[model samples]
Target: MTSHAATPTDAEAIPNLNTRNVALDRVRTFLTLVVLLHHAVIPYTYFGQTDAKSWIGFDAIILATDSFFMAMFFFLSGLFVWPSLADKEAEKFLRDRLLRLALPFALAALTVIPIAYFAIALRRSPGTTFAVFWWKTITVGPWPSGPVWFAWVLLAFDLTASVLYRVSPNLVDPINRLSLRGCGRPTDFFIFLLVMTAMLYIPMRIYFGPGRWFEFGPFSVQASRVLLYPAYFMIGVGVGAANLHRGLLSMDGRLAKNSWVWAVAALAPYCLLWALIFVKRGMLENPVWLPAWYEASYGFFFSAFSAATLFAILGYFLRFKRSGRSMLDRMQAEAYGMFLVHYPIVLWLQYWLFDFEMPAIAKATVVFVLTVVSSWAVTGILRKIPGAARVL
Candidate 1:
């Protein structure tokens, strides 16, 4: 997430060489790669349901990734914000954030997103020109931002946090205290997060319903989960406020010690979610307006699985913090760039592979592998340009 390395405009909170959490860096890189994988296999999943080849296993993966990845990304992105704000003036922080987040988001929204969707647009208008499609997307209608939506949303959160930090530096201190208390008993933190997320998320989800998007041209977010993301981001800020090393994420802390327990916690909710899915499809018959009770129950499972998996991932990464060199290290610097550019690559690859008669597993595997390699290579080349590393 934080990349652990600072640019001229941005500062690293932890200065000591020994204090850097390489595990988090690795986790961030892994999440970026997972983005590629998620998009690659989506065409073969029931949700996307685009390609002829569909896999039940991919449905499972898509369910899990859809539930957790972006939320975890927000959490990780928030980890460094409090510290970064502490070290810079408000004006400088805004400038740095603009450069780091907004510039790339703008470029991708205007360029990369249109190119990716053109493939989809061409399906309906078989002979549409690239120029015509691009113009129509920007000027006339539906300009989907795709994955770059995350970048803009994160920028908004960072800006909001800066304002909150200015109002009261100790606003998140209570959360910091709780994070400290959870060091030797992470179940407490897990329970707290689950309760908080459910309270914020479930009611909105019920009101808005799933599949609703807050779309306005290139900018859009899931209408229901708008509040949910900020809660996770602020919690991240709280956890990293102070005493990061001795907090719940400490290498020797109970969170890391009982990673297996957290994994089980995650699994229980995952199973519950699938059961609900079965009920929806088989018994409930996929009603337009799901019953309030059913929605609430599904929301509970979704929140539980999401919160548990966050802990599970963090705990596992912390447990293996000192496991020597990792493949994640190689792509660490390019993770952000890869995320920004990867949607187009993955979508185009799926489009190209749409006509193939290959099995779902083989197609997904090929698309995912090639997307990772191609995105990684492109990011590597992009970073070589003078000053590109600062933003990418």
Candidate 2:
């Protein structure tokens, strides 16, 4: 849920960010923390009701966060791709991506993911050895990437965009033009994104049925929303390709001026999503496969809410783009590292807390606060190692 800079090597430090997007960086950092909060509260949600106590509020949080966070992550990541590709050679770009993305993904898949999943393994088989579980997981069975799946997927998108850039640097010029037109009318972009994502997503959602995943070895992604993320990513590439300061995300633009309206637009579809959930659970009794009409309705609401919230968040941040000295700026450099390393810390904390006799809200709060601090502290230490800052 965070954007990365250039990769570091043993002799180098973190990439020197001479030109920065403070608003986008803050937004990305906020989303990284939101990712932590999402994981922390999942156990208390209805779908992931692993805790002794559950909360309706956490269900709301899960529903909203799950609907948009990962896609927003892809969008944020894609924002910088066009420029990066322009600035660097294809070989250097690919190498930097491999080091920054694939390296962390590979290391985390082998180390952090096993440790995190061990908590679940223990729950399933209390006496299971970590070594045995790790072996079986890597070789014989399902190996969930945890949240680090975003890294690999983003790298793939970057590579794809890179190739497309070579084919035509102006490939997304039309989208950029639309973004320019959308500055005063953000809903135009929202509708375009909604229609595009719904078209790419709804049929797949109905066909794959939401819970299914496409998995190969340590790689996996939600089957239903696979195309949705790419659509968001490409949109980002288009908007960021040219006139970033004058396009839809301009600080002085109408999108920022009308942030409140975007928030309301976001809320309407969010409420509609809840209503559809209600219908599915209450009226239809939560059938395994809902009718096509219900699935289409759910997809429409999902896409609408997602696009609206994205604009709302971006607009709100753009409105405050010149605000001095935000706290999120401090962690912006380390946000990607925090994201990469936080999963096991959070999962372990949840596992330890699962047996405690406490309310879900209190437990989730403690886990979230502690996870942010621990993850931040751990990333700080890791970045201190030579060349670690580059990749982390």
Candidate 3:
């Protein structure tokens, strides 16, 4: 068996993740925080939250910020995976990633499946009551929401990669200038991105159909979300392995160097995206544009805007240099656990605080803040347990 070798720079030593890579750690922490933010803002969108004086206004497409986590998490996960994997032979790499992704996934699913059983039980009425809902939930009932599907899909992807590795490891590898010795150009990479995206999404929409617009909980189209979101992850892999960090770094003091400038210039595109989305949403609801092609196109354009805007935001923020690797370290330690566990915590708090008289926006804001603080706190607490650190 040919053992995998490390990246040439480290000469095969895995950097103690805890000691190094503050930026990456912070990215994980930040993404986790935003994910909670995204989920917490639900319920108000669809369920129409109750407030102090009880004003009920609905949320629009901006609720799609949830996918921003989709984008970030996949990208960051891909960022670390490539270098880490290169150190091992494909067989060992598959085994390692499987254990890392699959164990947590199975444990999380099994653990939460029961809790979801109970939660759905709590929400139901007597006729088709607690036992009925619980049975369905444990079997096929609702309540397995946010972060739930990620584990399942990630495991599936890992398994797929394993099969592909055995058959054609080179075909499975992300196309990269660094690995290919600089053969692929930027235009080629962009086309690769577009092709992967088109392959994943266009077919996904055809097969799975447009996902139900969920304002709360964690249900998504299981059909192909498993494969689709990984496109972004693979794109990130190409970017990182192609060694584009210097180019990203040197893009300083440009128009994009200031976030506000991006904001202003992006205003027109943002408005156009919103307008098109509104038209699409209106048409979709009216039954005129609810077909597969329309749904697929809708997801495509919105994502295009999201990606463009994300680039602008990252381009601006990356120029920033922050002090205090220490804060990042502490947050980073708690991050993975926080990401895995925070949704329920946030939901439970939302339920407990439901009786409190507050505006919907205010309640969402409070939940957002509470979710971050409590998740961070609980992650820290969990890590103090002897065995917890390993899983987290």
**Against the true structure, what is each candidate's TM-score?**
0.96, 0.95, 0.74
Give lDDT tens digits, candidate 3, residues 1-392.
00000000011114344434334445555555666666666556642342232223434423435334465456555544455455567777666655555666566655644453343235444255545654665465454544655654555554554455457545534564432432222224334554566567666666655553332233333443445567776655544442434322223324225545444544554555456557665765645325676656655654554454445455444445223544545666666777766766666666666667677788777878888888788878877888767656
Tens-place lDDT per residue, model 2, 1-392, is: 11111111111111336545578778888888888898888888787867778999999998888787777877777776787788888999899989988999899989988888898888779999999999999998778888878777877888899999999999999999999998877778888888999999999888888778888887887888889989998998898887787889888889889888878888988999999899999999999888888888888889888888888888889887547898788987788888888888878888888889999999999989999999999999999999998887
What is residue 66's positional error in candidate 1, in angstroms?
1.0
Candidate 2 residue-wise lDDT at 346:
79
lDDT of each candidate versus the true structure: 0.82, 0.82, 0.51
lDDT for 101 in candidate 2 is 85
Kindly report which residue stretches of model 1 are placed more than 4 angstroms away from their true locations once superposed. Answer: 1-18
Ranking by TM-score: 1, 2, 3
Q: Which parts of model 3 are misplaced by more than 4 Å?
A: 1-21, 46-64, 89-95, 126-136, 139-145, 162-174, 178-195, 212-221, 224-227, 242-270, 280-285, 321-329
Query: Relative to the unseen true structure, what is the C-alpha lDDT of residue 124 in candidate 2, on a scale of 0 to 100?
Result: 73
> Candidate 1: lDDT over CA atoms?
0.82
The weakest ten consecutive residues by lDDT in model 3 span 1-10
lDDT of 2 at 238: 94
